[model samples]
Target: MFSEERRQEIYTIIREQKKVKVAQLAEKFSVTLETIRSDLKYLEGEGLIKRCHGGAILGKQEIKKISKFSDSFDISCLLHDLLIVRERKDRKPEGKVCVLGSFVVDIIANVDSFPKVGELINSKSNSIGPGGKGTNQAMAASFSDAKVHLITKVGEDHFSKYAYKYLQESGIDSFTIFQTEIEPTGSSISYLADKTQNNITATYLGANNTFSEQEIDISLPYVSEADVLLLQGEINIEANIKAAMFAKSVNKIIVLNVAPYSEDLKQLYATLDFITLNANQASHWADIEINDINDATQAINVISGDENKKVIIYMDELGVVYFDGRATFHIPPMPSLRVDTMAATDAFNGAFASKIAAGGTMHESVLFASAFLSAFIEQKGVTAMPVLSQVQARLKSRLEDIRPQIICNEKRCI
Candidate 1:
């Protein structure tokens, strides 16, 4: 058997038995004592077991004791404490969000700069990991304590297991994730410019484009229960439209993040509760030239069309511009060391949706998301996204530094 398969089995045994001796594992597997010891060490490193002198036990964190002073706490404080307790007891998430998108394995090569056409250059480093806007956003939402359901299609291949393992580890529900036998898993090759932190990418849609009408039917019930349904342009336009229409019929809040720009999605703009995009996407959707905050404000006004649609334009280093029909606020970017810029927008969208689902006001949610993206961009690879605690801490620490600049309608500044 393969080492990974053997290690997985051993992990299961230790989990079911609660504890197991090294000698017993060695005897059961017909392996040498040294091999069993190595397995135990590996499991321990993965935080699946706690090694003792002769055996290993399941690794579980001890629950903290609530303070006796809670009896005198206010009703709101008491309720907050109770919710925390409930989350700890059930190990289930509270905020409900459905992310309808794609999951592509990203192959990234870091280079000092882009090569000219017909030229070749050696990369500084290369890595492969979980990517695709949909998966990244779903995982980001999961990290922020949202009960995320990711509905995406992947091929039935080796790359598919990475998606399964990642979702399992992140505690996001993947039951709605579909698999295609005919097409290979979607993938992207990104060249990261080391000096400028910019990335150029090319993608193959693959199974992402294979989401069928049947899969859409299967996802309706789950999507109906969601507080928010997040859609991106990575998947087929038909699937995105179908999901949006279903969510609208059920009165679920629809948040559309327009990436890879699709002209067909323009028809659904009126139905969207919130629309998030970068400058290029906004320019395309609004049919105007957008280069700065002033240009973005004008473009958003044109696209919003006096409706209640909220528009968020992510302005890279200049921060984000938020228009809630009445007011346009400019939120400054949080301070962070520059790293990979691959997942910044996904982090923002996921964190924003997570905060909104958790009952935060629009302004508060944006602030929280900004903090999350700041922290996320400081790290590299798929693990760049931070947990809720980290985001909250960053928000608290940088509260004064990253305050939003109210451009107009000063009455509603958050």
Candidate 2:
């Protein structure tokens, strides 16, 4: 056997037994005593084991035993135990995610309906908050327990404070968030109809347009370190293209969310591992009118032909359709009370990207993302986004409800 494989076996033995003698390993592997000693030395150097008196033991630091305590035990012992637990949790490995997008302030107003060209109307309510496809998606990924790095541009204005504070509180690394002195921060004005829950939006690409290829190049280190990179259409198209190319160079998985329908994204499909879009955006990209799942399937086939590209089309209320070149499947939506649907797509993309970064398969990620959005839309705004635990709980409940169908399907296949 190869030395590396033998060493791995030796490490496993040491871990399982907590200690192992050199003679025993040499005899078990049919190797010389010198070879066993070398393997043990290598493992010890790599911190997988510790050598002592012709034997080796597991490398993990020994935990101290707590003494017997009475009812009047000191509080410091409890604190020490809590500290140890926290340290162990913190030292565990975690996945890294990089998000490239825009950070815009959303000025939302509730209106009765669309006004005529020369008509005037009064809004029921108005509120402003931090938004933008990039910021929202980054926040979503962070809430899903991934270490997220958000790359975007904002102006050195008052609006930028919201981005800073939000990212800091969300535990997202914003070191790549460039600040422009000339351009103002991006802003979006939306009018939401109270009855139908449909809305129209207008965005001012202020600082969002300022991110150039140079800025994208500066973020190459973060992109290279990420297991998965997420891009959206809110930033400059050239910068997005550069980001995609850089990620591809480093063999990082790329998940692109084509929002607001950009014609430039047609050239990017071949470079992306997965492309997510709403029904209208997919219809436009595929040059077909997608009225339902059948139309979406046709569109997916048109867009993903010949290339190994995957596509996800969000069909409102119906569900989401996924096409992975070889097969097509529909993920049913989880039912929930709809309060605000503005951030639904962002929530889905973020959770999906998080799952991908955490090494989940495409189907698993989509299921988790669907459950996350179901829990997200039940709340009011961006502040109401659900965490990873809440989403997992909801997904568990959903799976339990569908267990019977799963069992039946398995039996039929068998």
Candidate 3:
């Protein structure tokens, strides 16, 4: 169809349906999502339609919302979220997530390759910033406009100063940071191997080790207010157990990212609402080598140990495979010129937790988190994670890419 004819049809459809999804329009026209987006862009420019999160609306109210929210924050992202929420009010979760985790200051350097025994390599670039499973996840949740309270311990030192600075600059407006005088804040040295874009990090979790059960008790007030509790393996085991038990008692949605996996956490596996880990971690825990979708599905079931646990495994080139208790869904990896992947998992977990907390079904949150991660791998550092608008811009394209890859029903995955 010609551009003018397609736009007319899209206008008519919007008038009829009130709101039209980009994917549906692209499918109906037998065109690319970007093409439909362009048509919508032209129509929106003509003041005939308003573009929402993943679709277009047929009213001026979206424009009013844009003007109201534009004065603060990134207007495009917040406006997009508002329009979507208004369009689907029932899906809006509590909009709050509480993360129980750790904080770390990273000293990262870029080099040609791993240094040989007793050899020194010239560093290409280096940076110091705040990072940790907990810190990165909290920032990612905040990026999605989820109110996040990161409960972690830091040392009374200059690095602690950087911790607060990094979170503030990264758009985290809330914190439950605690300081310890006994040990300095956690620190790590990461080497980014430039040739392959791989990374190796060695960390000393300083004050984070000092977080006790008492500290977990102190954080209960914040945890009680959240719809989701996001946990990671970076902190002490006792703290994680205590936090998990409390969140379970409160009947909150509990999610765990088993990075740097620990066998000690097996105790909490049966009770978790969602579990995210890479293929290697799943393999180690489930005692299975993940080769394909079938292998991944088996690994998920073994690790989950029961049908009630939802599991997600991140495969390097094959993308993500998720088991929603009974069935498995495999989503193809988003194509990108990946420069650094160090923070991809962190960003994914954070975005995933926020989405799941917002009442997003398993596949919906997986797609959303993967969209956030696709934009994330193109850059370096956790701080370089994309805003909601960038992620939203990719959502339609992602749906297009993911539809063919989603193999449902009795274990058709890969």
Best prediction by TM-score: 1
Better of 2 and 3 by lDDT: 3
> What digit string (tens of lDDT, one per residue) describes model 3 on residues 1-414?
224335656866786789999999988766799999998997786566889999999866545544543343233233221111121122223478999887888899999998989997799888887788898898788777677878877887888766755554555545656667788899889999989987889988988877766667867987899999999888888888888999889999999999778898787875589988998889988999988877887787677664458889988678898888767778888887888888789989999988888888888899999888888889867778787878988988657886525456554333
Q: lDDT of model 1 at residue 124?
A: 97
Candidate 1 Cα RMSD after full superposition onto the native fold (Å) = 12.4
What Cα-based lDDT does every candidate model obtain? Answer: 0.79, 0.76, 0.78
Report how far residue 168 has shifted in candidate 1, in Å: 2.4
Of the candidates numbered 2 and 3, which has the greater TM-score value? Answer: 3
CA error at residue 133 for candidate 3, angstroms: 0.7
lDDT of 1 by residue, 93-159 (tens): 6678999998899999999999999999999999998889998898788777887878877887898
- How accurate locally is residue 411 in candidate 1, as Cα lDDT from 0 to 100? 23
Predicted structure 1, TM vs. truth: 0.76
Look at candidate 3 and give me any clashing residue pairs: none
Segments of candidate 1 deviating more than 4 angstroms: 1-92, 410-414
lDDT of 2 by residue, 258-355 (tens): 89798987778767999999999998988999888778777877766567488788887877888654577777678788888887899999989988
Residue 147, candidate 1: Cα error in Å is 1.0
